[model samples]
Target: MRIEIIAVGTELLLGQIANTNAQWISKELAHYGANIYHHSVVGDNLPRVVEAFEQSRKRSDVVIVSGGLGPTEDDLTREAACEVFEDELLEHSPTMNKIIDFFKKNNRQMTMNNRKQSHVLKTAMVLENSEGMAPGQIVEADDSTFIFLPGVPAEMKSLMNDFVFKYLTEKYQLETKIKSEMLRFIGIGESTLEEKLKDLISKQTNPTIAPLAGEGDVAIRLTASGKNPEREIADMKTSILERVGHYYFGSDSITIEEAVQDLLVQKSLTVGSAESLTGGKFIERIIQLTGASSICQGGLVAYTPEAKQRVIRVPKEIITRHGTISSKCAEEMAVQAQKLLHVDIAISFTGVAGPSSSEGHEPGLVYIGIKVKDAPAEVFHYYFDGSRDKIRQRTVNKGFELLFHKLK
Candidate 1:
């Protein structure tokens, strides 16, 4: 089914809030084999919303709208929907009782405006909202389905997952369930990764290949539609693994830090870091995952030359000669951190992440170092292009990438 999303909020248009609801809805709908052709953002104006609804109805069989479903004067989603469908609004007694019960349970007073949330169009099927006061609605008119959800993310998600998805799935008798697998790749540019897998992508049929680029990483999503979700997922996994097994790190929700943490636990290894331009970002990411103390020995933010010399014990002479931005300095930093923290492995980042050159080195020049037991310290250099924060983020990911390869 061709679906379109209309997000109604002046705050979204003014950039006060991001329209993440549209993105989330599109993703969820795609799982049921719905094609999202258009995403429109209309301010909280009735005429513009009606025009948007008219346009969406022309091309889309399903129109899902989010926002403006609040207990306030500016909230006009229900009224606009009623106007479009030529339906009259009526109070839903069950919904009204639920809203009243919610206020009573919380020991809060219900104002007269709160009663507006109980109004639903006569032709609409009220979708219960257990999370919030505003209930969602699903209506059919002119052979097109319109689902109106609350602007709040938690309420919208609950309604969609609990009611809307099941309703559509049953109504359509959807035989083929769409499954997607995301293959995460680092240490490679998106263009280069696409070039390597160009042939597989060109001949794609059942499982479609889509490449998305993110900060310092590339994600290739493989989607397949079939009656059996397990079989479809297996086929997608096998096909993608055959093509990009070497570069693939993890799937879907698995992050690089989680993968690194799994590896650390598997090998019974402890890790330490000496940060320069990254400023302890590497360790920060590691610790964000739980059970970090089991694997993370310690971390030192050696941002300055004095910090490097004092904390990690990088030799004063080495900093004076290599100037804290060289591969030699990175190597010594890692080695010194390993000795100081007494960890199984040590990673170091030394870089000039700035708008100007540092120690005769240009900005965005980074050196990532890794030192392991019974192995010589190794350093890798990278020349990135972006702001200071971007360069630092690049260095942080590069540090993890290097350590991942070393552990492998």
Candidate 2:
């Protein structure tokens, strides 16, 4: 079914509050095979809201409105909805009792203005709000469905999960199950990955491929529709992995830190890092994953030439000769960190992440080093294009990517 979202809040237009509710609703609705065609943001003005509702009813099967459902004077979602449908507002007894009980439990006095929270359209179905005072409304008019939800995120989420989803499932009698899988890839750009799988993407049918670029990585989603959700998801995953397995690092909801943690546990290895341009971002990510203390020995942020020489003990002569952004300096940093931390593996990152060059090297020039027992310390050089923060993020990911493959 085609759906449109209307976010009603004057604060959104003033940039005082973000419309996160609309984004969350869109994602949740997509799971039920509903297509979100458009998103509209309207102030608390009744006229504008009524106009938006009229426009949405013409092109969408479902129109979901969020916000402006409080007891305050500016809360006008119900009024606007009633005006659009030409219906009268009436008090819902159950909603009124809930609101009174909430105020009583909190030891607060209920004012006459609070009665407004219990009002609903005469022809609409009342949706119980377990988390907040303002209940939601669902109305069917002229073959179109209108859902009015509270602006509060927790209340809206509770109503959608407890009532709206089930009601829509029974009302529409939807049969086809939609399933999706996310394949995470590092060490490759989105454009390059798309070019490699262009042939498969062009001929997609039941299983479609979409690539999304994210911070320091790319994700490819494979979605399929069928009667049996399990079978459809299995088929889609198989088809995608067959073509992109080499670049794939993990599956849905699995991050690089989790994959690295699993690998370290399996290999019984400890790790340490000596970072320069990335400023210990790699180590910070590693430690954020639970159980990291089992494998992470320590880390050092050797950002300056003096810090590298004093902390990690990179030789002064080497830094003076090759400069801090050189591959040789990165290798020495990794080797020194390995010995200092007494870990099985150590990784280092040294680079120029800036709008200008450093030591005759251009910006976005990075060198990653990996040191492991029985193997010589290795360094890899790369040149990237982006802002300073993006370059630093890329350098950190490259460090982890190189270490992951080396250990594997």
Candidate 3:
């Protein structure tokens, strides 16, 4: 099917926020093997929207539109549908009742303008919006289907997932569906990861390999269209990971922190931390995951040398001899935190993360220390370039990555 996404709103044209609906819809429709040719953004003008609809009707079999379905005067999707499909507007009582009851439950007055949202095309099948006030519509005319959806992302997604997808699949008798497996990696740059998988990516056919880069992490998305698609994608992913398995941390939307948490639980080991540059960010990320309370003892934000000495009980001599940002101080902090918090393992981050240097060390200079119970403590040095937040985020991600490998 030739599908076109029309995003309606003057707000989108004015750059108030991104037209995320188009991006999300395109991805969702791709699962059903949709051929999306054109994506358009139209302002809240009646003539332009109608013209846009008519032009799309000439070429595309399916026209999916989002936005401009609201109570305000700018809401003109139903009006455009009436004009384009030559259908009269009909009052949908069930939708109005839902909207009225929503206002009653919320203890708000139902303005008369809200009635504008309760109307549907006369010959259209109503796409009910359970999450929001505006009801969506599926109007068919002249052998083409016009899907009128609310601009709000949540509303559009709900309608699409619940109704539109099933309808499209059943009507078109779709046989193939897109499936994807995302292989996540840390402690590697996108360029390095791409180079490692260059042959697999270049010579792929059934499942195409695509690389994605994010802050502190990179991913290879393996996508394919076929019967038993997930299994095929998984087989491709396993082949790719065989060569770079050490860098591959987890897969399919798993975060690096989640991977570390799983490793800690599997080993039944507890953890704690002492932080300087990241200021408890490492511990914070760990504790955010569910079941963290069982494995995470706690952490101390020992930003100052005095705090490191007094809180985590890092020896003052190490700080004096090697400076607070040195590897010696990092090792001492980890060793002391393990003893102080009484966890199986302790991690420490000490760095000069800044727009400027500190203690004669340049910005982005960092040291990560790890102390495993009944083992020797060690510290790793690194230099990262970015803003303070980026450097701190890198520190946290690197700490988890190192911890995962150490536990493994």
Candidate 4:
């Protein structure tokens, strides 16, 4: 089905609140093989919402709307849907009584404005909200389905989980299903990866390979449509891994940090880090995961020269000879961190992230170091171009890439 999602609120346009509902809904619908063609955001005005509805009806088989369901005067989604479907606004008596009971149960007064929420399309299917006051609605007209949900994220999610997902599955049983699998990679540029997969990409038919590179990350999505959808997806993943398996770190919805955590748990290894340029970002990322205290030993923020020498105990002579941004300093820091934090493995970062050069080194110059028990220390160098924040962030990102290889 060609689904178009409409988010109705002035707050979304004004950036008062993020339209996270559309993102969540799109990912959920993808599992059911639904084609989400477009997303429309409208203000809390009746005329604009009606115009948006008119446009959506022309190009889509399903229109799912979120927000603009409340007791306030600006909540006009119900009126707009009624106008588009050519139906009269009628009071749902049970809904009104439920609202009255809700106020009495809470020991509060129910104003007449609250009764407005009880009005809905005359021929709509009522989806009683378990989390909020307004009831969700569904209407069918001219072979198209329209679903209206509250703007609140929790209410919309509950309604979908409890009623909407099941309804869609039973109502529309199409023959073919389209499934997509995302392969996430790091430490490799998109252009280089594409060059390696050019022949396979050009010959794509049943399973199409699309490379997505944005927001400082690269991903490849293999979409296949057939009877045996899951099996085909697995085969595609295996084929792609045969070519670029070393760079592949995770799959759909798995972050690099989570992948590392899984690896550490499997090997029963604990880790620590010494930071110079990344601050505590890498350490904080590890601690954010549940049960991290068991596997994550500790960390040290060695921002200053004295801190590095005194805390992590990187020798002052190494800093004097090769400077703080050198590979030698990074290796020493990691080796010392393993002793200081008493971990099975230690990671260290030293970089020059600046608008101007630091210690005669250009901006974005970084060295990431790693030292594992009874193994020689290793260091990797990289140069990234962007703002200071981007450089620091990329330093941490590259550190993860280097560490992944060692874990294997």
- Candidate 3: list runs displaced more than 4 Å: 11-31, 35-39, 82-135, 141-143, 152-163
1-408: candidate 4 lDDT, tens digit per residue: 889899999999999999999999987877777778999899999999999999999999989999998999999999998889889888889889999999999999889999999998999999999998899999988868999999999999999998888888778875567788899988678998898889989988868899988454589998887777788878778888898988888888887878788889999999999999899899998999999988899899988888888888988999899989999999999999898889999999998989899999999999988999989999989998999999998888877777776787
Whole-model lDDT values for every prediction: 0.87, 0.88, 0.90, 0.89
Error of 2 at 272 (Å): 1.0
Q: What's the lDDT for residue 403 in model 3?
A: 95
Query: What are the per-residue Cα lDDT tens digits for candidate 1 across 1-408?
Result: 788899999999999999999999888886777668899999989988888887888888889999988989889888888788888999999989998988899999989999999998899988989898788999988778999999999999999999988988888766666777888987788998888888888988777889999876789887777766557667766766786666677888888888889988999999999998888899999989999999998898978899889998989999888789998999999898898889989999998998899888899889999999758998889898999888988888878887776666
Candidate with the larger TM-score of 1 and 3: 1
Lowest lDDT 10-residue stretch of candidate 4 = 169-178
Clashes of 3: 1
**Which stretches in model 1 have alpha-carbon errors above 4 Å?**
18-35, 69-71, 91-115, 126-135, 153-163
234 in model 2: Cα distance from truth in Å?
2.5
Off by over 4 Å in 4: 161-163, 175-178, 214-217
* Candidate that would win on lDDT: 3
Off by over 4 Å in 2: 97-109
Q: Give the alpha carbon lDDT tens digit for every residue of 285-322 in model 3.
A: 98899999989999989898898888878788888889
Whichever of 1 and 4 has more lDDT, that candidate is: 4
C-alpha lDDT of residue 58 in model 4: 90
Range of the 10 consecutive residues with the lowest summed lDDT in candidate 3: 225-234
